[model samples]
Target: MSRIGKKPVELPSGVTATVSGQTIEVKGPKGARSFTATDDVTIAVEENAVKVTPRGTSKRARQQWGMSRSMVENLVIGVTEGFKKELEITGVGYRANMQGNTLKLALGYSHDVDFEVPAGVTVTAPKQTEIVVEGTDQQLVGQVAANIREWRKPEPYKGKGIRYKGEYIFRKEGKKK
Candidate 1:
């Protein structure tokens, strides 16, 4: 048995969970999130806890049982606590700014790249090279951050470009004479 699967998911106050067929929906103070479980996985929501079970003893079912449960549990936690992703610009002229609902990024490009902010997500630039993305959905927050970072990935030579906060960029040595 999976230790994570055996652990019961504790529901916080003001959060509601419902299991309908293969779909599990969790609503919290921040927002509501839902996910569909595989046929082999089953979920049961009680008064203040949620339980996950495998429908059969097959290996496939056992594998999916814990995975599905953990996913559901994360959805619940995500809706309640929300998620955040931070990015930092590492170049001299590289910077990020927000105007209204649009994000303006200057990453040494001739023209600035403007990204539209999606609903339920907030983008903030605490400093010229710092970006903070906040949202209730973990997937959306991470994807957006990744997309932004892709615009200008850090280069090894000068360690310049956009990168996640606390990310390490291995510096490369100069060419030999």
Candidate 2:
């Protein structure tokens, strides 16, 4: 038995969940989110809680059991509180600013890099060195943060690059003369 799948996801107050065939849709304060599960698992909502079970004893069925349960839980949380990711820039003259719906970044490149913010997600720059990404979908928020960081990854020598707010970069010493 899957430990996570065995536990039903409880519906918070003011949140409603509906299960139709293999699809489950959750509606809450934030918004409505739906997830379609594979035939390897069966999804049901009972007593204001969502439950997922494997259809067979095969490995694929078991795998989908846990994953489906987690996805359902994420839907509940997404429509309620949502997800957020933060990024920080380091280095002299490196900064970020917003232009309308686009985010302009200065990372020691030949020219400023303009990143167009995608729909359904909000990007903000409270300070020149800080970038905040928020959205109802967890994957989208995380992917946006990673794409921004990909522009200038933190180096082991100088650690001069964009990284997550709490990320730690291991410093490397220069060659001995």
List TM-scores for all candidates, in order.
0.94, 0.97
- Give the clashing pairs for model 2: none
Taken over the whole model, the C-alpha lDDT of each candidate is 0.90, 0.94
Scored by TM-score, the top model is: 2
- lDDT digits (tens) for residues 23-89 of candidate 2: 9989999989999999999998899899898999999998899999999999999998999999999
CA lDDT of 39 in candidate 1?
Answer: 93
Those runs of model 2 whose alpha carbons end farther than 4 Å from true positions after fitting are: none
- Which lDDT tens digits does candidate 1 get at residues 1-177? 777888779999999998899998999988899999999978899779989988888999889988987888888888888899999998888988899999999999899999998887899999988999999888889999998899999999999998899999999998999
